[model samples]
Target: MSEVALLLQKQVSKGSWVNDKKVALIVSGVVLAMMVAFLIVPILSILSRSFAVSDGFGLENYINTLGTSRIWELGLNSVVMASLAASIAVSLAYAYAYALQRTDLPFKGILRIVIMVPLFAPSLVQAQGLIFLLGRNGVFNRFLGFDIDIYGFWGVTLANSLYTFPYAFLILSAALAVSDARLYESAVVMGAKPFRIFRTVTLPSTRYGIFAAIFVAFSLSITDFGNAVVIGGNFNVLATEIYNKVIGQGQFGLGAVVGVMLLMPAVISKLLEKQISKRQHAQVTDQSTPLQIRPNRLRNLVFGSYAWTIAAIFLSVPLIVFVASIVKLWPYNMAFSLKHYAFDVQNGTAPLWNSVGVAFATAFLGVVVVASAAIVSAKFKTVLSGPISFLSILPASIPGMVLGLGYVLAFNNPSNPFNMLYGTFPLIVLLYIYYNHAQGFLISSTSLKQISSTFDEASTMLGGSTLRTLFKVTLPLIWPTLLGVGVFFFMRAMVSLSAVIFLITPQTQVAAVSVLQLSDRGAANQAAAFSVCIMLIVIAMLLVVRLVLWLAGAKNVTLIR
Candidate 1:
């Protein structure tokens, strides 16, 4: 061959090599585009409407909304309430995680499992349980001859702490699990005091996790509307206020203004969490060994007590709801009955079925979408990968109520292309997946990142197409994570409130929303029944998943260990 021709041939071969990965690029583009259409554009539209005025886009709406003293009061209320809740939750979660991870606490497995009970149930269920326990005419209150109020700030704060405790515990436990035992051993050899060692070594090591938990807890607490709406009577937080403005009064402009304000703190917290997560990954290296605590009598006793107390509190909500679900009536009858389960009042169990349908659709669709996007973004790192990854985790920071409001404004418009999805079933499914996509993406991407890149290179060299390799190699390797993602989606979708609350129509009512409505109308027992049904569905689904995994010879996969 001529020299020029040889050079051209080499360049063409290199171009062909680059072109071979166009499948990844195309998948990345499609995922990113879907994210923009569903997540990004709706958020932008809501933000833009915050500045909309009669003539054109301006600050008049913001001025009108923020100039009111009520707005400032609501903002202050949210900050104070969320800060208090986050502090309590993080403190409890840290101690619980520490006991489970660092100490040889008794019943550690049971404690760990019980601590996650709050995660499966809706926050409203917790609030209602609290009401049944401590509200006016409550069983404990009346039995003890005391009148305690479970309303306003304290109620909301406590319920929020309960609702967000598991999130913090997960982060903190993961942090504690991967610590370097050598540090503690060296401290022991140097004769460092226990408190000193904990302060200097343990605290410093898990600081990123501590901060991440704090931010995640605070963000979740402030943005939550279910607990606030149920327990925060006459105590308005920013989230409930936004719901009132947007849904109650049809003041989209005002709601958008508050949502825009809520967005600022949430976005900052999310960035901080992202940074902390990145820092947390470096805490353990190949040389790190698992820390095993030698039990000290007094220390073990104290830690075990702490763990038990926290677990009891975490389990109380669901337990109380379970009892309430079977009761004929509260404080009056006190007789057990299954009439509430009949759900004869509101469409007679149809809502629960609809919820199941929504949850199933969300699980299937969520796993597919999040897994594909995660694999592409994690493995390929294409030009659009960064934005795609950001979009995946963006929902963690955005409040469900705000996202729902955005959907209402964006898709409900006559001029919008998605108007057909305004009150449809598919829109709810999309919202469910989008709202809970972050956890799925994080789990899947983390799993994918652990598998070495050599596998992909080898697969390509062996002439396997990218899709073929993904289905045959990558999918099987990360199948456990995918299963976890499905369960996560289904559980969240079934228990979810804020995201699909506004989107649910009379014809498409969901169980969780029905619980809210039932509680609102003073049918606390029926609400509890619905909550129990939701929990039962989640537990059944989990069991089925585990059974399937075992039957398939994948006995090691756990939904959440």
Candidate 2:
């Protein structure tokens, strides 16, 4: 009887394992189908369009695009500007992150928040603010009696650097936050100097992070359209060339060719990033002691000054933007006025409301999509796991403008089942979700990775199914992270410019696009005012989410992820 009972128990365990695997396969299949439909099909459609010729599909478009000396000039400009911006942003962000994570600086929270200002507003806001401060008739030229010109290459480079700074800071901060105290102690015992220890021990540990930050900043700078359009003037890059080709000249083939070219650098950088990350060893082990920040007066003072200076530069952009928005006239008059806030541009304030609605929708649906992808990829061990994981993070390598162009190419055709969604708000929301999917997926996966798999095993042993364990155990533990992901999607949908630019119809114009239009038609103050509204909405959203987290007894949880 004892042997029979033991055999029966073994059979029951095997049954549970089979049930769990089946469920994982189903979930993985569903997620993979969605990614292929929404992500893969669109990208392929655009690539096909690039090869389409008058007679049939051919390489005529690529040959023509590459043969142009103008195209080569734009490509060189993009590579050079992107390289400079990425270097500047990464170098500054490294110092800023080091100050926050390793030093005993006061008001580190405020300094950190200050650097994130660029993330709150549209990317063009940096260029707009620079114009207000240093344009031909800007504050410096008009009031400070200095000749200044904020346009063309240097202007766009500076704007891109400021725009990409926060992203780098986030990656570097995470890298510096973890260190094994034992390594530092051993170095000190060997009588290594501080700089030598930093060069040998600190730098090597965070090398992966530095590479990651460089990749992010480089990708952002190279693909950015907002800053280049606003401040580039005659200095065009590949991003603007794509816009001019498709939107201005109505040449989808040429635009598609540019889009394909844009993918090359991003793909190469992503491949290199993967190789570098594979070489990084685990920094924190079971027996590792966390490195503690020791207070040093000179160290604090030096880093404090450096951090605040960077913070002040970051703060000044939005500050001047607010000042410009309310002033009667930017450089001619200093009197206060609310005329710009009236939003006299096309569609008045409808775009702002439209963006709010879209942001809410994106937040709700994005949480479901990204959370599902994360749960399936992280929790399941299925044959589909490798493909699902690869596709989920693949969007990070594709530029926003390229993805937006792909959406146009893929869904605009009448034969496509998703054609009805082409010009609608739902389509725009989907674009925003997938355009920013990789980041949200990463955040969710990181959170899910922290929760032990022992809970799943225990639940299975007690006769719980995979779905039951997910809801009864996993969701309860990671719901806060899901909330953070929701907030992230909300913020992104609110402020994003490039991806949605191609998707918006006249009726579905979002606030970010409105800012672009206003700036384009030379309504600089109105653009500034529109930007202020977007920033306020983002801040309000953050506060509301924080309040909800506080009420839920998860007060320590950050909404930014």
Candidate 3:
């Protein structure tokens, strides 16, 4: 009887192990299927459409697109503008990040917050503010009597530089945040000058980070549509070309060809970034001492002035935008009025409310989808983990305009099973979620990785099922991160313009599209008004999330992961 009882206990333990594996397999499979269905299939559809000629599948579209001098011109414009913007953004951001991290600068917290202003508003705000400040009849030309023309290549380049600055700052800040103090001490003992030490030790230490920032800023500049659309008068890039071909001329094949062209540089840059980042070693280890910032008045004064200048440039955009939104007419009438807030555009404030709904849905659904993917990839040991992980990050390489175009080609057909979802708000929500999936997945994955696996081992030893372990052990520890991811999704959905541009319809107009329409129709103040509303909504959402975190006793948790 004793032998039989012991055998039964062993068999029960084996059964629990099998159950856990099965659960993991199912979750992993589900996540993989969703990614392939949403991400891989839509991109394949774009490729298919690009090859679909009148004579059958062929390269005629590519041949025709490449045959034109016009296409080459546009391509060159895109490359030059992207290169300039990336170079400018990366240089300024590297210095800004260095000032904040390396020196004891005054107003560090306020400057940090100010620099993130671009992230809070739509990308077009920079272009709009530039127009208000530097255009033909702008503040400078009208009030200050300066002749400035901000309407072509230089205009687009400057706007994109500002748009990409915060992104570069984020990357470089993290890179500079950690370093071995011993290296600095040794350099000082060798009697090296500050400039020499910076060139030798500091620059080399952050080489990978600099490369990564360039890659990101370049990709963002090349793929951005909002800034170029608003201020790039006749200085067309590939992003605007895709819009004109697909939306303006109704030429899907031509648009798909342009999409393919745009995708190449992003993929190449991502590959290059991966190769370069492999050389980056851990800067802080168990034996390493943290770098301490020593106070120097001269250093503080110089960096403080530089950092605050950049911050002021960032703040100027929204500040002018808010003023423009409320003024009766920009640069013409000084009287303040709420006339632009009337929103007499096509859909009016309905699109703003629609955006709110979409943001809420995206926030909820994105948290579930991204968090599940992260957990499955990080915690599970199934065969599906590799594919799931690969697909989760694949969206980052695909440009938003390309993805939006792919959605049109994929779902707007009669034979397609998901044809019914075309031009629907649900589809728009899904686009927002997947379009920003990579960032959310990385955030959740990073949080999960910091959590020890011993919890899983201990839970399994007690015969708790995998799902049980996830709900009881994993979710509790990472719920705050998941909340942050939700807030991120909400913020993105509010301000995103490119991916949803091709997806919005008459009945499904969103706030970002509304801004585009108003700006395109020459209703600059109305567009500013609409942008202000969107920013307010985002700020309110952030405050609410922060309040929730504070009430839940999770103090000092950053909401913008």
Candidate 4:
């Protein structure tokens, strides 16, 4: 036989090229098309409108937006608040994470759980909780015989700190959880002081995590709308400015300008996050031993006190909401009542049900959309692979409010074919899937990478098709991670505000928006009641997922943070 023929025969015998690449190509094409239509187009639409003027395309909008003294003031305000919030959140989160992950603290599990309570509700809930405790007629002020204003810069900063700190805690906890114990042992043997060891060893080890936490906290604080909307008062920031421009003034052009302005910090933070994430993963090693904390009474006591303080702060929101929900009147009547629980009387339970429906649809559809793209990018090499992967994660860099505005500008016009879905429920689901796609894609892609391609080869050798191998072998193994993605999607969509705030109409009102409305209408008790309902629903859904995973014998599944 000829040499080429002999090589071809050898390859055929090895079963490496048996499966066609058409499947990968086809999947890649579909993913690319969807991303272009949904993600890329909308952003371009917003950018396009920002430059449009009545005469023709020009910088009139940009000039007007940037020329204004108020815009500059708002920008400065956003930067100052974001910086302060980031600093405070990172300090508290680092302490809380170290306590739970590196110290012999008692009740660490409960503390960790309490820290994550903020994640179960909207960021506005924290603002509401702050109001309940410190507003003019607040419980604390009434009891202490002093009025404290919870409506301006201080309120925004404090509420944002509470809302954004949990994210930092999760990142720092993961970083602290993975380290080489041998380094600590060596330092101990060399007679390193505890403080010195912490300064050199611990600080250097978690440096990337610290940066990650700061960037994430900054991005979240700057982009956050819920907390700012509730307590911002006359404190103008870019996010609230965008809300005012679009909803309050009907200035789509000006809103787009602010959207672009907000994108700068988000993009910078996301870039830093990506680089730090790459560096932080190096902490995990094959030969590394997990760090174990030995009982040191003084050390444990200090860290435990710090952890409990943070837990109390974190729990304050939900606790206040629960109490305020059942109370008949604030600061006047101490008597408990069930009247606020009758959410059906005013806004009814439809908004809550709508939120559940949106969340469910997002979870199911998000998995399918993100997983297909992940599978193709993870397993196959194609020209579209790089672009597909980049597009999949680009949503994380885009703020939810910007993306929502993009959707409005992109889909609500007659020139767009997607105009049919302008106010429909599916548009909200699609917006959410795009808004939160990055994390799910990362999880699915990581899981797929850990799986062996040998399974595919073996299946091919056994006369199974590519589809059969994927279904019978690949998917079954990664279902646990997929389940985690589903739960994450559900939780985020249930509590989502920014992405859907611009999208909701009278018919498509959701619980989060409803809470905002109630609070805006001065129905504090009803808003609190609604906030509590959302939290309970999220918790119950989490429990249901955990139960399902347990019944399925999936012990490795992590359904919550």
Candidate 5:
């Protein structure tokens, strides 16, 4: 005990009254336990249920899973679709990022925003747009005088690519942008041809990012229910299978099995992304700037045209859907009308507001949880630091479905003391934390690393308490990141559904799920209207965030890297 006390004292300091590190260590253990509870409980429940029979923990669930050929078909379809979508998305993003970083393109800012237009689109809304453009009676068929059957494998690939391209673009662009220019300069000095220079310098430098993009995009597509439900006519990806099994038939046991299956790729992608992000946090200096390609007029025009054409096509699909929403009868009604905009608020507007209220609550609670978790792990070092850090990243690896199911199985049990939180608005807010916790941690850590440790030392020397220094110094310095976290978490909660789907009861139906339901019910016009509303809300939020930043005289305002 004496040695242990001595060790602890040596580790922190003698003068300190409160062992901040010890407190951090104890709190971290509790948080890690909660994290494990959030991760393992539901997954284990499904696994145990699968095994349990009239006999015991046996292979009954495996047999049940095997018997469902349709289940197997969905898995196979998901892998294929993800592969195709990721391949197309990465290639397209590479070209787009290449164009953005390499060529001297005109209207670069406009093109960038245009390409990211999909981010504002609610998942259901994007699918609605795809239907309007490619469904048998879609505007594309009428406008081009061709019956475009866009609701199948081809449609899934296109829609998935469109939705995921932005992620690939953002990631790969940063990867390329950070490459050292001297490498390219040396290769050129050696008289290497342009293509050879690209082969040796640019391509090799971004190889990791390219591969990362592929996995990240593929996993996202596999887990995405939005595109799969809309364009995937009998495509039956794992995500849609989960939806069909659970929501359509109320087959909770089967849905839990499918949910576990769908969670695999998402978990893998999240792990790889976290790894990439850790490495990506390394600062790129002025010397690391890639050699700006002074493309010849012909080459510049070619790459520029490639990017523009792809951007226009992807963005146009949604625009066409928005336009079709107003047509009383698409392809027949040439004149526009506002009939589609007639929102039936009485039927479900209340539910939408419930979702919005949940979202706001999520943002509020998420900030508190993130700020506390971040401060604990970051400011106070303790034995659990390593575990705290590891658990903080667990949410990133686990899919929303996995986490949501965990909550259900853990909290849904009648005997559980915490069961009261199940199916409540608080459950949705907690789901947001389960998914977005890692992001908030990242935002906090990045901001913390920028600050000097000397500030804390100086504050302590001036007789300032740890709490006082935190309030007056640390908080002020990291306020920008905190604000960014608020927006990021809010947006994520607003747009998220995979996990929230399970947590949200009938009384608490979210807009995202509603959009999915609307699309599934073939209420294309209403879905479009909801999609438009989601986009407008996001736009408004972004504008408000920006305005708030400006008002506070803060120059930095991006919510995510």
Candidate 6:
């Protein structure tokens, strides 16, 4: 045998390089294709249907859409709400990040977890709370002796901003958490004031993350149809415009146009995000240890108080929602009822079973993709790994509305040869997975990267195949990470709205959308009930995941901080 052949075959076992490489390549490609099919196919379905013309190919829908008063108004609303909510959300995130990174506060870890409440809980919770507090004759209104309306622009903006803080915080905090401590030390040595050091060192260092957070928060806000439909009250936005077109008018062409419209901003934002992020990456040196900032007494107290206050607000809102769900009329009777849980089955359109099944399936599939891609991309880190990593994260920047709108055009086309998935449960599952990959991939990849490749290399040298090494050596070491990914996938899929609103058919409805629809039709109590249910399921999953991790010897797996 040739030296290379023998070395490869000796895998210390029965395998040639070609054989192992071929297996890996084929499997990887198949995984990638399935992933693409799940995500891209549905998106294309929406786009194709939008562009389909009577004379073959024309911009009739786009032109008609641009001219519509409703669409124009909705588009304007979407922009303003996204801008305002993102500003508020990002500000809180920046404050929380600054406090945690630069302040020396007591129970800092506890403060972090409180801020994370929104990340774990769905926005629906906040949506319901806003209603209970300000929705004509709500507790706060009656108790304080004033009628408050939780609808239109202000209502949606408030809920979206309050709910999205955890995400911005996570992004900004991670960006600011680890920096060169030496720089701060030098600044102090040079007699630089605290504010000067922050402006020159801290802000510049984490500018990439801050920008990314802003873009991400903005994308989430404008794209979110849930909070809008629940609280928007005829407030026109690109997202709700798509909803009106598809569901209200049954016009897919107009719907796709709105989808395309929504895609434009996301694409621009994503491009800018990439450019900034790339420059930021180039600035990073290969230093293993990042310097942690030491906190001063006053600084610690101020930051801790800020983070704690925001977290307290997040924690309180959900509790408020839960309480309101049980109230019969909220300040009307001052009495409670259990009848809201009866599941009215609304217009005979509420497909609770379908939504639950799809959410679960989406969660399950999300786990598979996260685990597989994380192992392949993070473990290998080869020429192809960078592309895989990018593929996983590229969707992160694409808003759910765009993905849904794309699906309407892509998969719903009858002319398309592979159009079988249209109006099917499979479409919902596919979209759920697509929107969720970046999240799970983030968790799984972070966990995977912490493990050294030496373990795998040594396992392979001792005759274990790559697959075997992954199962035996790699997985055991990172089981906690995998567990975390699975829990998040389940929760996110359950709570998702962007795609469900677009892909939902009578036969394939979802809880997230159902809650929105119920709220739309003025079934606040029922919507509140359903939203609360979803939160409980998510919280339950988190609990089970933590318990399982504890049983498996996973340590300090707390997500609170």
User: What's the lDDT for all of these models?
Assistant: 0.86, 0.90, 0.91, 0.87, 0.74, 0.74
> Over the stretch 1-561, how does candidate 4's per-residue lDDT look in tens digits?
244543544455545344446777888899999899899998998899899899878999999999999999999999999999999999999988988888877788799889888899998999999998889877778788877888999999999999989999998998888889988999999999999999989989999989988998999999999999898888979999999999999999989999999998899888877886786557658898888778899988899888888888788878988898898977578589989888854549889899999999999999999999898787666888999999999998899999999999999999888899999999999999999989899889988989876676676556555567789999999997888898889989988898889999989989999999899888888899999989999899888888888898997776664
Give the per-residue lDDT digits (tens) of candidate 1, residues 451-558.
876777666555555577688899989987798889989999999898888788899899989999998889898999999988889889888998888888888765
TM-score of model 6 vs. true structure: 0.88
In angstroms, how far off is 481's CA in candidate 5? Answer: 1.2
Model 5 Cα shift for residue 272 (angstroms) = 5.7
List the candidate 2 regions with Cα displacement exceeding 4 Å: 1-24
TM-score of each: 0.94, 0.95, 0.97, 0.95, 0.91, 0.88
Q: Model 4 Cα RMSD, Å?
A: 2.9
Tell how far residue 272 is off in model 3, in angstroms. 0.5
Each prediction's total of clashing residue pairs, residues at least 3 apart in sequence or on different chains, is: 0, 0, 0, 0, 0, 22
TM-score of 1: 0.94
* Candidate 1 lDDT: 0.86
Cα RMSD for candidates in order: 3.5, 2.7, 2.8, 2.9, 3.8, 3.5
Query: For candidate 2, what's the RMSD?
Result: 2.7
Candidate 3 per-residue lDDT, tens place, 1-561, comes to 144443543555767657778889898888988787688889999999999999899999999999999999999999999999999999999999999999998778899988888888789888999998898868888889999889989999999999999999999998999999999999999999999999999999999999999999999999999999999998999999999999999999999999999999899999999999988888778999999999999999999999989998888888888899998888688699999999887777899999999999999999999999998988877899998999899989999999999889888987877889998998998899999999999999999998887776666556566688899999999998899999999999999999989988899999988988888988889999999999999999998988999999987667764
For residues 415-508, write the lDDT of model 6, one tens digit per residue. 7565898888877777777787887788787877788766766765666766777779988887666666666667777777776676777667
lDDT of 3 at 74: 94
Which has the better lDDT: candidate 2, or candidate 5?
A: 2
Q: Give the worst 10-residue stretch by lDDT in candidate 2.
A: 1-10
